[model samples]
Each structure stands twice: as structure tokens, then as C-alpha cells.
Target: MENNQDSRQRFAALVREHSHSMFRAARAILDCDADAEDAVGEAVLLAWQAFPNLKNQQAARCWLLKITVNCAYGQRRGQRRVVYMDDLSQAAGSAPSPEPSGLWDAVLRLPEDQRLAVMLYYYEDLPVAEIAKTLGVPQGTVKSRLSRGRERLKALLREEEAYGF
Candidate 1:
């Protein structure tokens, strides 16, 4: 019981430390604020369940991040092509366009591998090796995905601007 309490405290602290980044990654994956929140919540649950397997405290953030990304991707994957609607005020009047659609839209359009790489790299500011470690993929794969994803995003943004997305 005491061990469980200790783990929960540790987990809670970790969540407070990295929740923002996790939400961003989740939002990036799912492309909706609500779903992102849900994904982060789900990831927190799953992370607690798997906390027994955690080896080092230092890897906690990355581990939680990876879980959150996977959870967001899983939710999106399960229900593909379902659009999330935001406020009419944002779409119609004020609210000031929360996040640049081109950036998020392009990121959302990326393939899973590339999207993960881009999120870990740009959002989390993780090194390639760390991303690879979190993703359990080779550093070369991470680099390739980052390169391709960035190129594709650039093209997509340009296309969006040209075609008015």
C-alpha cells in the first residue's frame, strides 16, 4: 500500500512536470483539444498501470510522452476520419484562430512514423537518439522520418496557402 502511494505521488509529480508537452503531442496527433485532453488522461492511466516496468526515473517524461502519443494515435486510428468541431466563434467571428491550421493540418496529415518523429523533435525538443529510444526505433529511422515529415509539411503548408485551406 505504501509502495502504491509512493508510486502515485511520483507519477503525479511527473504528470505536473510534463502534462503540457504531453497535451501538445496528443493534440498534434489527434488534432482536437478535447481528444488531446482525453488522450493525455488515458495515457496517464496506462502509464500508471505500466509503471512497474519503468526502470529509471530520468526516463519518466519520455516514457509518459511516448505513451500519450500512442494513446492519441490509437484513439484516432480506431476512429479514422471523424472531424472534431471547435467553437463557431472561432470559425466565424473572433477567438483568433487558436493554432495555425497549416502547421497542425500538415502535422496531422503526416504518416505515423514521421508524425511521431516530428512531434518528438520539434515539440519536445528531444534529440534523435532520445526519440529513437522512446520510440524503440533506430536513430537513422528517426532522422529519415524527421526529414521526410518536414519536407512534406512544408509542401502541404504551401499547398494549403496556394489553395486556401
Candidate 2:
């Protein structure tokens, strides 16, 4: 019982430390904020169950994110598309149009592999090798994905600008 308590405490600490990044990574994949939160919660539960098998403390971030990505993908499966209705007051009011945060919408339009790689490497600031391990791909593949993602993002953003978006 004491050992279990210790494990729980350790897991809690790790979650507190890394949960934000995990949520962001999940959000990048899943799009909706609510789904991102759910994915992180599910990942924490799974991580708690498998914490004993985690050999390296240093690898906790990667491990937790791996679980988050898996859970996000699982959650995405069989989920129907949902369109949210905007508030009538906000919609009807002459509110100033918010400027787009550069390249974010374009990033969202990227293919899954490239999107994940770009999010992990650039947004999460994780090293390519670690990202490769997390994604179960080679370092070369991670690099290629990053390259392709960047190229695609540039093209998309330029097209948006040219069309006056």
C-alpha cells in the first residue's frame, strides 16, 4: 500500500509538471479544446496504470505525450463531426474581426504525420530524436516530415494571403 501511494505521488508530480505540454500536443492533433482535455485525462489514467514499467525518469515527458497521442487518435476514431453554433449576440454584433495568428490555421491543415512532427519539434520544442522515438519513427522520417510540413505550410499561408484571407 505504501509503495502504491509513493507511485501515485510520483505520477501526480509528473502530471503537474507536464500536463500543459501534453494538452497542447493533444490539442494540436484533436483541434477542439474539450477533446484535448479529455485526451490528457485519459492519458494520465493510462500512465498511472503503466507507471511501473517506465524505466527512465528523464523520459517521462515523452512517455506521457506518447500516451496522450495514442488516446487522442483513439478518441478521434468513430467520432462524428460536430459543428458548433456561435452565440447570436456575438454573431450579430459588429465586433472587430480578429487577425489570424500566422500559420496556425495552415498548420492545422497539414497531414497527420507532418502535423505531429511539426508540433512536437517546433511547438513543444522537443528534440527530433525524442520525437522520433515518441512517434515510433526514424529520425530521418521525423526530419523529412518537418521539412515537408514546413514547405506545405509556406505554400498554404501564401495562398491564403494572395486570396486576401
Give the winner by lDDT.
2
For model 1, the local distance difference test gives: 0.84
Q: Which pairs clash in model 2?
A: none
User: What does the lDDT read for residue 60 in candidate 1?
Assistant: 88
Against the unseen true structure, what C-alpha lDDT does each candidate score? 0.84, 0.86
Best by TM-score: 2
Candidate 2, 43: how far from true, in Å?
0.4
| Model 2 worst lDDT run, 10 consecutive residues | 82-91
- The Cα RMSD of model 1 versus the native structure comes to 4.7
- lDDT by residue for model 2 over 1-165, one digit each (tens)? 348889888999999999888987788788678989999999999998999989899999999999999899889884787554444445678575544546766777789889889989888899999999888889999999999999998988888888777
